[model samples]
Target chain A: MEITPAHYTVLSAALFSIGVIGVLVRRNVIIIFMAIELMLNAVNINLVAHARYLENLAGQVFVVFVIAVAAAEAAVGLGILLAFFRNKETVNIDEMNIMRW
Target chain B: MAEAIAFYTLAVLILGLGVAVITTPKTVHSVVFLVLNFLCVAVLYVVLRAEFLAVIQVLVYAGGIVVLYLFVVMLVNLKRAPEAHEDPRRLARLGLALSGAVLLELAGIVVYSYGRVTPASAPAAAGPLTGAGNTEELGWLLYTDYLIPFEVASVLLLVAMVGAIVLARRES
Candidate 1:
Protein backbone atom coordinates (compact mmCIF):
# COMPACT_ATOMS: atom_id res chain seq x y z
CA MET A 1 0.00 0.00 0.00
CA GLU A 2 2.49 2.57 -1.22
CA ILE A 3 1.48 5.99 -2.46
CA THR A 4 2.95 6.03 -5.91
CA PRO A 5 2.85 8.75 -8.51
CA ALA A 6 0.19 6.72 -10.23
CA HIS A 7 -1.98 7.17 -7.19
CA TYR A 8 -1.63 10.90 -7.53
CA THR A 9 -2.59 10.66 -11.17
CA VAL A 10 -5.69 8.69 -10.35
CA LEU A 11 -6.63 11.19 -7.72
CA SER A 12 -5.98 14.08 -10.05
CA ALA A 13 -7.95 12.45 -12.80
CA ALA A 14 -10.89 11.99 -10.48
CA LEU A 15 -10.69 15.60 -9.38
CA PHE A 16 -10.48 16.67 -12.99
CA SER A 17 -13.60 14.68 -13.81
CA ILE A 18 -15.42 16.40 -11.00
CA GLY A 19 -14.38 19.70 -12.49
CA VAL A 20 -15.74 18.59 -15.82
CA ILE A 21 -18.97 17.61 -14.16
CA GLY A 22 -19.10 21.02 -12.57
CA VAL A 23 -18.67 22.64 -15.92
CA LEU A 24 -21.46 20.56 -17.44
CA VAL A 25 -23.97 20.20 -14.63
CA ARG A 26 -23.75 23.59 -12.96
CA ARG A 27 -24.91 26.70 -14.75
CA ASN A 28 -23.91 29.15 -12.07
CA VAL A 29 -21.20 31.33 -13.57
CA ILE A 30 -19.25 31.60 -10.31
CA ILE A 31 -19.50 27.89 -9.74
CA ILE A 32 -18.29 27.34 -13.25
CA PHE A 33 -15.29 29.55 -12.47
CA MET A 34 -14.52 27.54 -9.36
CA ALA A 35 -14.83 24.32 -11.36
CA ILE A 36 -12.37 25.64 -13.90
CA GLU A 37 -9.97 26.44 -11.06
CA LEU A 38 -10.40 22.92 -9.74
CA MET A 39 -9.46 21.56 -13.11
CA LEU A 40 -6.37 23.75 -13.26
CA ASN A 41 -5.28 22.78 -9.77
CA ALA A 42 -5.78 19.12 -10.62
CA VAL A 43 -3.46 19.51 -13.57
CA ASN A 44 -0.92 21.27 -11.35
CA ILE A 45 -0.94 18.35 -8.93
CA ASN A 46 -0.27 15.94 -11.76
CA LEU A 47 2.65 18.04 -12.95
CA VAL A 48 4.20 18.30 -9.49
CA ALA A 49 3.76 14.58 -8.82
CA HIS A 50 5.57 13.60 -11.99
CA ALA A 51 8.31 16.09 -11.29
CA ARG A 52 8.91 14.59 -7.86
CA TYR A 53 8.71 10.97 -9.00
CA LEU A 54 11.08 11.46 -11.92
CA GLU A 55 13.37 13.87 -10.07
CA ASN A 56 12.65 16.54 -12.63
CA LEU A 57 12.46 20.13 -11.50
CA ALA A 58 11.02 21.42 -14.75
CA GLY A 59 7.53 20.25 -14.01
CA GLN A 60 7.45 22.13 -10.73
CA VAL A 61 8.66 25.17 -12.60
CA PHE A 62 5.73 24.74 -14.93
CA VAL A 63 3.43 24.51 -11.94
CA VAL A 64 4.65 27.93 -10.81
CA PHE A 65 3.80 29.36 -14.20
CA VAL A 66 0.45 27.67 -14.04
CA ILE A 67 -0.24 29.32 -10.69
CA ALA A 68 0.66 32.71 -12.06
CA VAL A 69 -1.63 32.17 -15.01
CA ALA A 70 -4.47 31.05 -12.76
CA ALA A 71 -4.16 34.19 -10.69
CA ALA A 72 -4.32 36.45 -13.72
CA GLU A 73 -7.14 34.47 -15.23
CA ALA A 74 -9.18 34.60 -12.04
CA ALA A 75 -8.77 38.33 -11.70
CA VAL A 76 -9.92 39.09 -15.19
CA GLY A 77 -12.54 36.41 -15.23
CA LEU A 78 -14.18 37.56 -12.00
CA GLY A 79 -14.11 41.16 -13.12
CA ILE A 80 -15.86 40.19 -16.28
CA LEU A 81 -18.31 38.20 -14.21
CA LEU A 82 -18.97 41.28 -12.13
CA ALA A 83 -19.60 43.39 -15.19
CA PHE A 84 -21.94 40.77 -16.59
CA PHE A 85 -23.75 40.49 -13.28
CA ARG A 86 -24.15 44.21 -13.12
CA ASN A 87 -25.68 44.46 -16.54
CA LYS A 88 -27.75 41.31 -16.51
CA GLU A 89 -28.51 41.32 -12.77
CA THR A 90 -28.11 37.55 -12.78
CA VAL A 91 -25.16 35.17 -13.09
CA ASN A 92 -27.09 32.33 -14.64
CA ILE A 93 -24.82 31.00 -17.39
CA ASP A 94 -27.71 29.27 -19.15
CA GLU A 95 -29.36 32.59 -19.83
CA MET A 96 -26.14 33.65 -21.49
CA ASN A 97 -27.22 32.08 -24.71
CA ILE A 98 -25.77 34.78 -26.87
CA MET A 99 -24.02 32.23 -29.08
CA ARG A 100 -25.76 29.06 -28.08
CA TRP A 101 -27.75 26.87 -30.43
CA MET B 1 1.70 2.75 4.82
CA ALA B 2 1.26 6.24 6.15
CA GLU B 3 1.73 7.71 2.71
CA ALA B 4 -1.00 5.49 1.36
CA ILE B 5 -3.33 6.54 4.10
CA ALA B 6 -2.62 10.20 3.50
CA PHE B 7 -3.03 9.72 -0.22
CA TYR B 8 -6.40 8.07 0.09
CA THR B 9 -7.56 10.64 2.59
CA LEU B 10 -6.49 13.56 0.42
CA ALA B 11 -7.95 11.91 -2.65
CA VAL B 12 -11.35 11.57 -1.03
CA LEU B 13 -11.20 15.11 0.30
CA ILE B 14 -10.28 16.55 -3.05
CA LEU B 15 -12.92 14.64 -4.93
CA GLY B 16 -15.65 15.21 -2.38
CA LEU B 17 -14.93 18.91 -2.16
CA GLY B 18 -14.80 19.19 -5.93
CA VAL B 19 -18.24 17.63 -6.27
CA ALA B 20 -19.63 19.77 -3.50
CA VAL B 21 -18.29 22.92 -5.09
CA ILE B 22 -20.13 22.15 -8.27
CA THR B 23 -23.38 20.84 -6.80
CA THR B 24 -23.88 23.27 -3.95
CA PRO B 25 -27.01 25.42 -4.05
CA LYS B 26 -25.17 28.50 -2.82
CA THR B 27 -22.44 30.15 -4.85
CA VAL B 28 -20.64 31.40 -1.74
CA HIS B 29 -20.59 27.95 -0.23
CA SER B 30 -19.41 26.51 -3.49
CA VAL B 31 -16.50 28.95 -3.57
CA VAL B 32 -15.60 28.05 0.00
CA PHE B 33 -15.65 24.35 -0.81
CA LEU B 34 -13.50 25.00 -3.83
CA VAL B 35 -10.95 26.70 -1.56
CA LEU B 36 -10.98 23.61 0.60
CA ASN B 37 -10.37 21.45 -2.45
CA PHE B 38 -7.45 23.67 -3.46
CA LEU B 39 -5.98 23.47 0.03
CA CYS B 40 -6.23 19.69 -0.09
CA VAL B 41 -4.43 19.76 -3.40
CA ALA B 42 -1.68 21.84 -1.83
CA VAL B 43 -1.24 19.14 0.79
CA LEU B 44 -0.94 16.56 -1.92
CA TYR B 45 1.82 18.68 -3.40
CA VAL B 46 3.58 18.50 -0.08
CA VAL B 47 3.37 14.72 -0.22
CA LEU B 48 4.94 14.85 -3.67
CA ARG B 49 7.79 16.84 -2.07
CA ALA B 50 7.09 19.80 -4.28
CA GLU B 51 7.18 22.18 -1.35
CA PHE B 52 7.56 25.21 -3.60
CA LEU B 53 4.51 24.24 -5.56
CA ALA B 54 2.55 23.54 -2.39
CA VAL B 55 3.33 27.01 -1.04
CA ILE B 56 2.47 28.66 -4.34
CA GLN B 57 -0.74 26.66 -4.55
CA VAL B 58 -1.82 27.80 -1.12
CA LEU B 59 -0.94 31.42 -1.69
CA VAL B 60 -2.13 31.89 -5.25
CA TYR B 61 -5.06 29.55 -5.19
CA ALA B 62 -6.56 29.26 -1.72
CA GLY B 63 -5.58 32.74 -0.60
CA GLY B 64 -5.52 35.03 -3.63
CA ILE B 65 -7.83 33.45 -6.20
CA VAL B 66 -10.45 32.31 -3.74
CA VAL B 67 -10.67 35.80 -2.32
CA LEU B 68 -11.26 37.13 -5.81
CA TYR B 69 -14.12 34.70 -6.16
CA LEU B 70 -15.59 35.75 -2.85
CA PHE B 71 -15.47 39.38 -3.92
CA VAL B 72 -17.21 38.64 -7.19
CA VAL B 73 -19.83 36.62 -5.34
CA MET B 74 -20.54 39.54 -3.03
CA LEU B 75 -20.49 42.14 -5.77
CA VAL B 76 -22.87 40.04 -7.80
CA ASN B 77 -25.12 39.95 -4.71
CA LEU B 78 -26.92 36.93 -6.05
CA LYS B 79 -29.78 36.25 -3.61
CA ARG B 80 -30.80 33.16 -5.49
CA ALA B 81 -27.95 30.96 -6.55
CA PRO B 82 -27.74 31.10 -10.28
CA GLU B 83 -28.76 27.96 -12.14
CA ALA B 84 -30.41 26.54 -9.03
CA HIS B 85 -33.17 25.15 -11.21
CA GLU B 86 -32.36 22.91 -14.09
CA ASP B 87 -34.18 23.59 -17.30
CA PRO B 88 -37.41 21.71 -17.84
CA ARG B 89 -36.37 20.98 -21.38
CA ARG B 90 -36.33 17.42 -22.60
CA LEU B 91 -32.58 17.23 -23.22
CA ALA B 92 -31.41 17.67 -19.61
CA ARG B 93 -31.39 13.95 -18.85
CA LEU B 94 -29.74 13.20 -22.16
CA GLY B 95 -27.03 15.74 -21.41
CA LEU B 96 -26.35 13.98 -18.13
CA ALA B 97 -26.05 10.66 -19.90
CA LEU B 98 -23.67 12.13 -22.42
CA SER B 99 -21.50 13.58 -19.67
CA GLY B 100 -21.41 10.25 -17.84
CA ALA B 101 -20.43 8.47 -21.01
CA VAL B 102 -17.60 10.90 -21.64
CA LEU B 103 -16.26 10.42 -18.12
CA LEU B 104 -16.39 6.64 -18.54
CA GLU B 105 -14.53 6.94 -21.81
CA LEU B 106 -11.82 9.02 -20.16
CA ALA B 107 -11.48 6.58 -17.29
CA GLY B 108 -11.16 3.75 -19.75
CA ILE B 109 -8.47 5.60 -21.62
CA VAL B 110 -6.56 6.13 -18.39
CA VAL B 111 -6.76 2.45 -17.52
CA TYR B 112 -5.75 1.25 -20.95
CA SER B 113 -2.85 3.63 -21.29
CA TYR B 114 -1.63 2.97 -17.78
CA GLY B 115 -1.77 -0.75 -18.36
CA ARG B 116 0.37 -0.36 -21.45
CA VAL B 117 2.95 1.74 -19.64
CA THR B 118 4.68 -0.06 -16.82
CA PRO B 119 5.66 2.10 -13.89
CA ALA B 120 9.24 2.08 -12.62
CA SER B 121 9.48 -0.17 -9.58
CA ALA B 122 11.22 2.10 -7.13
CA PRO B 123 10.77 5.66 -5.95
CA ALA B 124 14.31 7.02 -6.27
CA ALA B 125 15.44 9.55 -3.71
CA ALA B 126 17.14 11.92 -6.12
CA GLY B 127 15.93 15.20 -4.67
CA PRO B 128 15.21 17.64 -7.51
CA LEU B 129 17.14 20.42 -5.81
CA THR B 130 20.68 19.50 -4.89
CA GLY B 131 24.11 21.00 -5.58
CA ALA B 132 23.78 19.66 -9.13
CA GLY B 133 20.10 20.53 -9.44
CA ASN B 134 18.49 23.47 -7.76
CA THR B 135 15.88 26.15 -8.24
CA GLU B 136 18.80 27.81 -10.01
CA GLU B 137 18.31 25.09 -12.59
CA LEU B 138 14.76 26.29 -12.92
CA GLY B 139 15.92 29.88 -13.23
CA TRP B 140 18.44 28.89 -15.91
CA LEU B 141 15.87 27.04 -17.98
CA LEU B 142 13.36 29.81 -17.53
CA TYR B 143 15.80 32.47 -18.69
CA THR B 144 16.93 30.29 -21.57
CA ASP B 145 14.15 28.25 -23.15
CA TYR B 146 11.04 29.80 -21.64
CA LEU B 147 12.06 33.40 -21.34
CA ILE B 148 9.51 34.61 -23.83
CA PRO B 149 6.63 32.84 -22.19
CA PHE B 150 7.73 34.08 -18.80
CA GLU B 151 7.76 37.66 -19.96
CA VAL B 152 4.46 37.14 -21.74
CA ALA B 153 2.83 35.87 -18.58
CA SER B 154 3.83 39.07 -16.81
CA VAL B 155 2.38 41.11 -19.64
CA LEU B 156 -0.74 39.03 -19.55
CA LEU B 157 -1.20 39.73 -15.86
CA LEU B 158 -0.82 43.43 -16.47
CA VAL B 159 -3.38 43.28 -19.23
CA ALA B 160 -5.77 41.33 -17.08
CA MET B 161 -5.37 43.87 -14.30
CA VAL B 162 -6.12 46.74 -16.62
CA GLY B 163 -8.99 44.87 -18.23
CA ALA B 164 -10.50 44.21 -14.85
CA ILE B 165 -10.33 47.86 -13.94
CA VAL B 166 -12.04 48.83 -17.18
CA LEU B 167 -14.74 46.20 -17.02
CA ALA B 168 -15.63 46.67 -13.37
CA ARG B 169 -15.48 50.43 -13.30
CA ARG B 170 -18.24 52.36 -11.54
CA GLU B 171 -20.64 53.98 -13.93
CA SER B 172 -19.51 57.43 -14.97
Candidate 2:
Protein backbone atom coordinates (compact mmCIF):
# COMPACT_ATOMS: atom_id res chain seq x y z
CA MET A 1 0.00 0.00 0.00
CA GLU A 2 1.38 3.36 -0.99
CA ILE A 3 0.11 6.74 0.13
CA THR A 4 1.02 9.19 -2.56
CA PRO A 5 1.95 12.77 -1.80
CA ALA A 6 -1.27 14.06 -3.28
CA HIS A 7 -3.16 12.98 -0.19
CA TYR A 8 -1.08 15.25 1.97
CA THR A 9 -1.42 18.11 -0.47
CA VAL A 10 -5.21 17.91 -0.52
CA LEU A 11 -5.34 17.57 3.23
CA SER A 12 -3.18 20.62 3.55
CA ALA A 13 -5.51 22.57 1.34
CA ALA A 14 -8.48 21.49 3.38
CA LEU A 15 -6.71 22.44 6.57
CA PHE A 16 -5.76 25.79 5.10
CA SER A 17 -9.32 26.51 4.02
CA ILE A 18 -10.56 25.60 7.46
CA GLY A 19 -8.14 28.09 8.91
CA VAL A 20 -9.29 30.65 6.43
CA ILE A 21 -12.85 30.04 7.48
CA GLY A 22 -11.88 30.55 11.07
CA VAL A 23 -10.10 33.76 10.29
CA LEU A 24 -13.04 35.07 8.32
CA VAL A 25 -15.79 34.08 10.71
CA ARG A 26 -14.31 34.02 14.20
CA ARG A 27 -14.34 37.27 16.11
CA ASN A 28 -12.23 36.24 19.07
CA VAL A 29 -8.69 37.50 18.90
CA ILE A 30 -7.07 34.45 20.44
CA ILE A 31 -9.01 32.00 18.29
CA ILE A 32 -8.11 34.00 15.23
CA PHE A 33 -4.47 33.82 16.20
CA MET A 34 -4.81 30.08 16.57
CA ALA A 35 -6.47 30.02 13.18
CA ILE A 36 -3.45 31.76 11.75
CA GLU A 37 -1.28 29.03 13.25
CA LEU A 38 -3.50 26.43 11.66
CA MET A 39 -2.92 28.03 8.30
CA LEU A 40 0.82 28.09 8.80
CA ASN A 41 0.84 24.45 9.86
CA ALA A 42 -1.24 23.68 6.82
CA VAL A 43 1.42 25.27 4.68
CA ASN A 44 4.05 23.24 6.49
CA ILE A 45 2.11 20.10 5.70
CA ASN A 46 2.21 20.94 2.01
CA LEU A 47 5.90 21.64 2.17
CA VAL A 48 6.70 18.37 3.90
CA ALA A 49 4.54 16.44 1.52
CA HIS A 50 6.30 17.93 -1.46
CA ALA A 51 9.66 17.13 0.01
CA ARG A 52 8.72 13.53 0.57
CA TYR A 53 7.16 13.00 -2.83
CA LEU A 54 9.91 14.75 -4.72
CA GLU A 55 12.68 13.08 -2.74
CA ASN A 56 14.14 16.48 -2.08
CA LEU A 57 14.93 18.16 1.22
CA ALA A 58 14.15 21.66 0.08
CA GLY A 59 10.53 21.60 1.19
CA GLN A 60 11.46 20.34 4.62
CA VAL A 61 13.97 23.14 4.91
CA PHE A 62 11.26 25.55 3.85
CA VAL A 63 9.02 24.27 6.63
CA VAL A 64 11.77 24.99 9.11
CA PHE A 65 11.79 28.55 7.89
CA VAL A 66 8.01 28.66 8.14
CA ILE A 67 8.15 27.56 11.75
CA ALA A 68 10.67 30.23 12.54
CA VAL A 69 8.54 32.87 10.91
CA ALA A 70 5.52 31.61 12.76
CA ALA A 71 7.33 31.94 16.05
CA ALA A 72 8.26 35.51 15.32
CA GLU A 73 4.75 36.35 14.16
CA ALA A 74 3.19 34.85 17.26
CA ALA A 75 5.44 36.71 19.65
CA VAL A 76 4.87 40.10 18.08
CA GLY A 77 1.19 39.57 17.44
CA LEU A 78 0.52 38.45 20.99
CA GLY A 79 2.55 41.31 22.37
CA ILE A 80 0.54 43.81 20.40
CA LEU A 81 -2.58 42.13 21.60
CA LEU A 82 -1.41 42.47 25.16
CA ALA A 83 -0.65 46.13 24.74
CA PHE A 84 -3.95 46.75 23.00
CA PHE A 85 -5.79 44.96 25.78
CA ARG A 86 -4.13 47.15 28.33
CA ASN A 87 -5.60 50.20 26.67
CA LYS A 88 -8.97 48.90 25.43
CA GLU A 89 -9.65 46.22 28.04
CA THR A 90 -10.74 43.67 25.43
CA VAL A 91 -9.31 41.34 22.78
CA ASN A 92 -12.17 41.49 20.38
CA ILE A 93 -10.98 41.84 16.78
CA ASP A 94 -13.74 44.19 15.75
CA GLU A 95 -12.80 46.69 18.40
CA MET A 96 -9.44 47.34 16.75
CA ASN A 97 -10.58 50.55 15.17
CA ILE A 98 -7.66 52.71 16.15
CA MET A 99 -6.16 52.39 12.69
CA ARG A 100 -9.50 52.74 10.97
CA TRP A 101 -9.97 55.89 8.96
CA MET B 1 -5.19 -1.25 4.13
CA ALA B 2 -3.50 -0.22 7.35
CA GLU B 3 -2.34 3.02 5.84
CA ALA B 4 -5.83 3.71 4.59
CA ILE B 5 -7.23 3.30 8.06
CA ALA B 6 -4.55 5.49 9.56
CA PHE B 7 -5.03 8.24 7.04
CA TYR B 8 -8.78 8.30 7.44
CA THR B 9 -8.51 8.27 11.20
CA LEU B 10 -5.89 11.03 11.33
CA ALA B 11 -7.74 13.12 8.79
CA VAL B 12 -10.95 12.91 10.82
CA LEU B 13 -9.25 13.78 14.07
CA ILE B 14 -7.27 16.64 12.58
CA LEU B 15 -10.25 18.28 10.91
CA GLY B 16 -12.50 17.64 13.89
CA LEU B 17 -10.10 19.20 16.37
CA GLY B 18 -9.46 22.12 14.06
CA VAL B 19 -13.18 22.85 13.93
CA ALA B 20 -13.48 22.50 17.66
CA VAL B 21 -10.61 24.88 18.26
CA ILE B 22 -12.11 27.58 16.13
CA THR B 23 -15.66 27.11 17.38
CA THR B 24 -14.95 26.93 21.09
CA PRO B 25 -16.30 30.08 22.72
CA LYS B 26 -13.85 30.51 25.52
CA THR B 27 -10.34 31.39 24.46
CA VAL B 28 -8.89 28.96 26.99
CA HIS B 29 -10.97 26.13 25.63
CA SER B 30 -10.03 27.09 22.11
CA VAL B 31 -6.37 26.99 23.05
CA VAL B 32 -6.74 23.52 24.53
CA PHE B 33 -8.58 22.35 21.44
CA LEU B 34 -5.85 23.84 19.32
CA VAL B 35 -3.30 21.81 21.27
CA LEU B 36 -5.17 18.65 20.49
CA ASN B 37 -5.29 19.69 16.87
CA PHE B 38 -1.53 20.16 16.84
CA LEU B 39 -1.01 16.73 18.35
CA CYS B 40 -3.12 15.17 15.66
CA VAL B 41 -1.01 16.89 13.04
CA ALA B 42 2.09 15.55 14.74
CA VAL B 43 0.73 12.06 14.32
CA LEU B 44 0.05 12.86 10.71
CA TYR B 45 3.70 13.84 10.36
CA VAL B 46 4.71 10.45 11.70
CA VAL B 47 2.50 8.82 9.12
CA LEU B 48 4.25 10.87 6.51
CA ARG B 49 7.63 9.55 7.79
CA ALA B 50 8.85 12.91 8.93
CA GLU B 51 9.69 11.63 12.38
CA PHE B 52 11.93 14.52 13.24
CA LEU B 53 9.26 17.01 12.30
CA ALA B 54 6.64 15.10 14.26
CA VAL B 55 8.73 15.49 17.37
CA ILE B 56 9.48 19.08 16.55
CA GLN B 57 5.77 19.78 16.13
CA VAL B 58 5.01 18.46 19.57
CA LEU B 59 7.99 20.08 21.25
CA VAL B 60 7.64 23.51 19.73
CA TYR B 61 3.93 23.85 19.17
CA ALA B 62 2.40 21.76 21.92
CA GLY B 63 5.13 22.37 24.47
CA GLY B 64 6.74 25.74 23.95
CA ILE B 65 4.41 27.98 21.98
CA VAL B 66 1.03 26.87 23.27
CA VAL B 67 2.21 27.38 26.81
CA LEU B 68 3.04 30.91 25.83
CA TYR B 69 -0.50 31.33 24.53
CA LEU B 70 -1.93 29.79 27.68
CA PHE B 71 0.10 32.17 29.80
CA VAL B 72 -1.14 35.13 27.84
CA VAL B 73 -4.69 33.91 28.21
CA MET B 74 -4.33 33.47 31.95
CA LEU B 75 -2.48 36.73 32.43
CA VAL B 76 -5.14 38.68 30.64
CA ASN B 77 -8.30 38.46 32.71
CA LEU B 78 -10.78 37.89 29.89
CA LYS B 79 -13.75 36.78 31.97
CA ARG B 80 -15.85 39.22 30.01
CA ALA B 81 -15.99 36.64 27.18
CA PRO B 82 -15.44 37.71 23.58
CA GLU B 83 -17.72 39.78 21.43
CA ALA B 84 -20.18 40.53 24.20
CA HIS B 85 -22.00 43.03 22.06
CA GLU B 86 -22.34 41.22 18.71
CA ASP B 87 -25.71 39.79 17.83
CA PRO B 88 -25.45 36.07 18.55
CA ARG B 89 -27.91 35.00 15.90
CA ARG B 90 -26.09 36.71 13.06
CA LEU B 91 -22.68 35.51 14.06
CA ALA B 92 -23.82 31.96 14.63
CA ARG B 93 -25.57 31.87 11.29
CA LEU B 94 -22.55 33.32 9.58
CA GLY B 95 -20.20 30.82 11.14
CA LEU B 96 -22.43 27.91 10.32
CA ALA B 97 -22.90 28.94 6.73
CA LEU B 98 -19.27 29.80 6.19
CA SER B 99 -17.82 26.61 7.63
CA GLY B 100 -20.42 24.50 5.90
CA ALA B 101 -19.73 26.06 2.54
CA VAL B 102 -16.00 25.79 2.96
CA LEU B 103 -16.23 22.17 3.94
CA LEU B 104 -18.45 21.42 0.98
CA GLU B 105 -16.14 23.20 -1.40
CA LEU B 106 -13.14 21.35 -0.06
CA ALA B 107 -14.80 17.99 -0.33
CA GLY B 108 -15.93 18.79 -3.81
CA ILE B 109 -12.48 19.84 -4.87
CA VAL B 110 -10.94 16.72 -3.44
CA VAL B 111 -13.45 14.43 -5.08
CA TYR B 112 -13.18 16.23 -8.36
CA SER B 113 -9.42 16.25 -8.25
CA TYR B 114 -9.40 12.48 -7.98
CA GLY B 115 -10.39 11.99 -11.58
CA ARG B 116 -7.59 9.45 -12.00
CA VAL B 117 -5.81 9.45 -8.69
CA THR B 118 -6.69 6.65 -6.31
CA PRO B 119 -5.28 6.80 -2.82
CA ALA B 120 -2.03 4.83 -2.85
CA SER B 121 0.01 4.05 0.25
CA ALA B 122 3.47 2.73 -0.46
CA PRO B 123 5.00 0.59 2.21
CA ALA B 124 7.48 2.69 4.19
CA ALA B 125 11.03 2.15 3.03
CA ALA B 126 13.09 0.58 5.81
CA GLY B 127 13.84 4.13 6.93
CA PRO B 128 15.65 7.30 5.96
CA LEU B 129 18.41 5.32 7.71
CA THR B 130 20.95 7.28 5.76
CA GLY B 131 20.69 10.16 8.25
CA ALA B 132 17.48 11.91 7.34
CA GLY B 133 15.83 10.53 10.45
CA ASN B 134 18.45 11.95 12.75
CA THR B 135 18.08 15.31 14.47
CA GLU B 136 21.74 15.94 13.74
CA GLU B 137 21.02 16.00 10.03
CA LEU B 138 18.30 18.54 10.56
CA GLY B 139 20.56 20.67 12.70
CA TRP B 140 23.38 20.45 10.21
CA LEU B 141 21.08 21.50 7.41
CA LEU B 142 19.71 24.32 9.50
CA TYR B 143 23.18 25.66 10.31
CA THR B 144 24.70 25.21 6.88
CA ASP B 145 22.03 25.43 4.20
CA TYR B 146 19.77 27.60 6.31
CA LEU B 147 22.21 29.44 8.51
CA ILE B 148 21.30 32.93 7.39
CA PRO B 149 17.58 32.48 7.86
CA PHE B 150 18.31 30.56 11.03
CA GLU B 151 20.18 33.47 12.56
CA VAL B 152 17.46 35.84 11.40
CA ALA B 153 14.81 33.76 13.17
CA SER B 154 16.76 33.95 16.42
CA VAL B 155 17.09 37.71 16.16
CA LEU B 156 13.40 37.94 15.31
CA LEU B 157 12.50 35.95 18.39
CA LEU B 158 14.76 38.11 20.52
CA VAL B 159 13.05 41.25 19.31
CA ALA B 160 9.64 39.72 19.75
CA MET B 161 10.41 38.57 23.28
CA VAL B 162 11.50 42.01 24.42
CA GLY B 163 8.67 43.69 22.59
CA ALA B 164 6.11 41.41 24.17
CA ILE B 165 7.46 42.08 27.63
CA VAL B 166 7.37 45.79 27.15
CA LEU B 167 3.91 45.81 25.62
CA ALA B 168 2.44 43.44 28.16
CA ARG B 169 3.88 45.23 31.15
CA ARG B 170 1.52 46.51 33.80
CA GLU B 171 0.88 50.21 33.40
CA SER B 172 1.50 50.87 37.09
Each prediction's total of clashing residue pairs, residues at least 3 apart in sequence or on different chains, is 0, 8
Model 1 chain B: which ten-residue window has the lowest total lDDT?
Answer: B126-135
Off by over 4 Å in 2: B87-132
lDDT of 1 at B169: 91
- Model 1 lDDT at residue B65: 89
* CA error at residue B152 for candidate 1, angstroms: 1.3
Q: What does candidate 2's lDDT look like per residue over A1-101, in tens digits?
A: 54566677678878887898888787788889899999999889888776765556667777777777787788788888888888888888777778973
What is the Cα-based lDDT of residue A14 in candidate 1?
A: 78
The Cα RMSD of model 2 versus the native structure comes to 3.4
TM-score of chain B, per candidate? 0.85, 0.74
lDDT of 1 by residue, A1-101 (tens): 76766677777777777777777777787888888898888889889878777777788778878888888888888888887877778888777766666
Model 2, residue A38: displacement in angstroms?
0.9
Clash count, candidate 2: 8
Error of 2 at B57 (Å): 1.1
